[model samples]
Target: MADRGAGTMSLPDDWPDHANAILALNRMGSFDWDLDAGLMVMDAQAHAIFDILPEEYDDRPETLAVRVPPNEARRLDATVSQALKDGSENYGAYFRIRRRDGTQQWTHTQGYIRRDETGRPRRIIGVVRDATQELADIATRRERLEQDTALREQTNVVQLTTAALAHARTVQDVIDVLKDTHGLTHLGATSLVMGLVEAGRVRLIAEGPAGSFVAGTDVTGIDEPYPMNEVVRTLSPRFIESPEEFAAGYPILWPHITDLRITSAAYLPLIVQARPIGAMGLLYNDRRGFTAEERNILVALGSSIAQSLQRAMFYEQEKDIAQGLQQAMLPRTIPSVRGADVAVRYRAAAIGGSQGRDIGGDWYDLIPLPGGRVGAVIGDVQGHDTHAAAVMGQLRIVLRAYAAEGHTPATVMARASVFLHELDTDRFATCLYAEADLATGVVQVVRAGHIDPLLRHADRSCRRIPVPGGLPLGLSAEFGSLEYPVSTVELDPGHTLLLCTDGLVEMPGSDLDDGMRTLTALIASGPEDVRRLADMLIDLAEERGGDDDVALLLLHRRGLDAPVGGGRLQQHVAPGDPEALHEARHMVRAAVHTWGARDRADEIELIADELITNALMHTEGAAIVTLRALAGGRRLRVEVEDSSSALPRRREAGESGVSGRGLLLVDLLTDDWGVEARGGGKCVWCEFDVPESDRRRPNRRR
Candidate 1:
């Protein structure tokens, strides 16, 4: 190379014709600068770089330096100084320079600096190339590099965030992952918008940054619309590069956003299953614009988040339906039993999850037994889910079956336990079985690893029955072999028995004894009825030990000699012929027998026939018959009823009518007789007293 280190002389020094002929070049430029003097010199081609005439730079470098753009002058000086300090023989920098016509063009100057022997810089010489084409080429390369870098960064962020969003089940879970993974704080200021097309509304389901925004506040009614509205309506992604842009579009959110210092934002429409349900917006505090790549990544995350929300809502609805169905299958109210008052209460769990709606294993039953007896049972299986509830239902049916077979309390429990053990079940259960016979005023109890029942006596005192306890059912192979002895107590009149599950007494900070004391206090207060008392007791337990499910059954014994009576019967019949009279007599006899007047059955039958025969022969069309049975000191009074609209005409004993003989027979047989009109019907009565000997006979049919 000829003089490769030449300062501003890298091109041939020949005439313009020679340089043009060598390379068929159309244009060229060269220049020199005097740094200390702040002067510059240029050739004809160099002057053309600034679009200036060649005479403009003759004998003066100041003209060219002065022609340089003011804003780029400092940059040009710095480049010149840097090149001289590095002692580079050749160097180039691209900058903007002003032309004499007040227009601008890009230039690339390449040159070197001349120095004295002491290494001090003297003058700067450079070749000024009109590099508008070169500048365009470099800018194209830079643009490509920037685009690639931005795309790479977006791909990385989307891949990482998508993985996190994939695992988010709840709205809170999404917020947590975003905060932790994306270095985001102030989560509460953020809102998740979900579209509700059916309601023609958009809902804010979840918000983060705990104290900033209320969890359930609805922004639907805000005065000015949100940019997210566009996202949803258009089903596209949108972004606000600055707070000014957002405020200009949404004036109402401006104040709220300014107070939060939100400067930039991205609104992404959430589309799932090829449908757009809503949009999500990410707000930032600085005016940071999201790249196209970033917007696309956010869209992917929004889609996944939308799908998760849909699934969660579906799960919640399913849980509610299952819970309702389960409760409907349970008893609404306990059955009524004579000689005893009964009550029951049931409760389910309050947890949320897959097993949330499955019933627990706690259960209670009050079955009426023969001879005015009531069978009571309270049991709990070994789990808190649907399987346990199924086992409990099976045990209940089996217990009732055994009781119906007339097994003793201990026998019923023994057989039930054995059946449960033999069943192909993986869970065990505890139970307490008891029977109360109101006639005998006795209670028989059997316990199998269950909580003991509490008895509140008529005296306002309490006692807990201690029966022989056995292992929980289903745990032993020889379940019935373990004889659980029967325990009995005299259930006196006005006394109450309470059977309950462990959930009643097993409170969080208190034990079984404390629960028993609380229950005892409740029962001792003497509630009016068994049902009322049962409710009070359950409420008390819930106040103290509501962590678990509760089940309780209460029974109150009535006095053995309590008086019982029958209601009136108003009957309408056609005027009786002989057949009608016989039917009326049969009805009176059956009524007296059902009212426990069996000893007077024959006498009442004959008296009713004579009275009814007289009424049928006297009245026309339909006749009403009435029967009344009054218990009077070992005797029953019988009444024959009919509607005559007129009183019967009685005759003296000497009167010789064909029906006159009927009254004489009634007077001879019965101790008393009378006639009275009851409403629209008249009652003719006769009484028969039981003999002293007959009264002592046992009433075997109860």
Candidate 2:
């Protein structure tokens, strides 16, 4: 026995029986462990505590392995080794040991290390006891029952949280889920703080409880004294059971959160695949300490959160990449056109679920062409992915090039279709291209498996222009339907022409025609400003979210600062095509009458017929006839173009000859005539002066 301090009792060195009696009475046993000799000496009472007889006892600790399970022995050895290496004065642990009857019993052990003068551990004095009865007592059973109930509640909360997190597709969405009123609060947390590990630093992504966030903590080092950092570093959970423990363990983080009145917290390492990706802290104000079961429950919850957060992060990254690619594929900016208010817009799709990316092939462009013409294009590729966007980019470039090459509307569309088919991609696109001559208010529109363009009248009423179309780009060329019909429409001053992908007019569960009619009504009631009208349509599409993208173009013809009533009309006349020549005559008559020159409609139609007839008879190609009301409706000019460089000369015609009489009639009409050399062709133009009374007449039809 060692000497005792004042007022304390001491036993003589020879009082072994007294110490044995005290240990036996308490159902505890004492042992002496020699570190240098690797041996242990246990008394009869200690053998009894281990449920072993005197004959079964061993002087060496290795011999005790027969009584202690291998797992229990290893755990005990490790605990002892850690305590000794850390210079711990004492250590205690609980383990399970199999008894002689093949039954498991809970056992506890405590050891006090004895160090020599040189500070090296020499021996250990310890006590072993059976803790089964202590653990099975009435109070402990009741406490464990409460802990079990709390575990069930916590598990339920975790399930609810996981369900909520399933819908989170972005990092911000994850934060919103965590900060939702009905969220994480069910986990018995008064406040929550979460951080993601980024580039060896923990970024504070979420902090709640309204103003509890400390400034300058948005990012922190992993080696900081904060409990979150501690768990992340160790890949283990930390239970701060009291404010005192929290303050002592995290001196730097305590002062900032003292005002929160937090009494306890649980910090968990958000680990996946045995590596920590981030960390989370659940703070408590009403609770004082956490039971072992509660700590385990929180750790499980943290694992679920880690998986969801990783998924959300990956989704956001993919979305960003998809959007960036789509934006790069689309036109960077629209070119301004003279004599028109042009507005263009594009919106990407809002796709959901594990698809992870939201992008599509919708695109719009404004291409300036030769001869005072501008091409407005709106198209959508067949899919919603990076591949579709790539195809769209190639198709848009080719379409622009064809339009800029002075091709007619139909030729441009056919060439684009051929280009797309030759690209060898298994994709197709619906497209509409409108070539408008702002000077003449004439729009030649060509459609390729796309919806009709909308024409808003000067009165703000809108209607669909039913343009005949061929198959979509790739399919048309594949099926040999390369001829796209062009429809001509007059875009009067103050009227607008609208072209958009079907995404703008499609409504789920509704017929496409019905959707178009609805769109027409919407446009009719929308504001008159082109830019504002474009915004309104796009905003509506955004509000009615769908799994498709949208592209739109609006071209509003500005009222010219010159004349108000005069107009121009053009028609292409092919050789030996009576219908085209007849259309050319009708166009001349209509333009003359619409310009209030009905009295001269007969003369104008006759002269236009003779010119078209001569061009068709003498040329190997088609004739283009153009009629214009000039000088504010006081004069009308007719021009006929042919792919021939030869100039026409007056010839004497006998009474019965019809071939040489065509140019003679033009000389007989009251008009000035001339010829101009065009590229590989010639244009013969004539002008007619109208009477003032007829010019001042109201617009009328014959």
Pick by lDDT: which candidate is best?
A: 2
Candidate 2 similarity to native, TM-score:
0.65
Candidate 2: regions farther than 4 A off: 1-144, 272-276, 354-356, 560-566, 569-702
Residue 646: error of model 2 in Å? 17
List per-prediction Cα lDDT, in the order shown.
0.66, 0.83
Q: What TM-score fits each model?
A: 0.46, 0.65
Query: What would the per-residue lDDT of candidate 1 be over residues 125-182, giving only the tens digit for each residue?
Result: 5566777887788899999898787666666665666676566544565556656635
- For every candidate in turn, the CA RMSD to the true structure comes to 16.6, 17.4
Clashing pairs in 2: none
Clashes of each: 8, 0
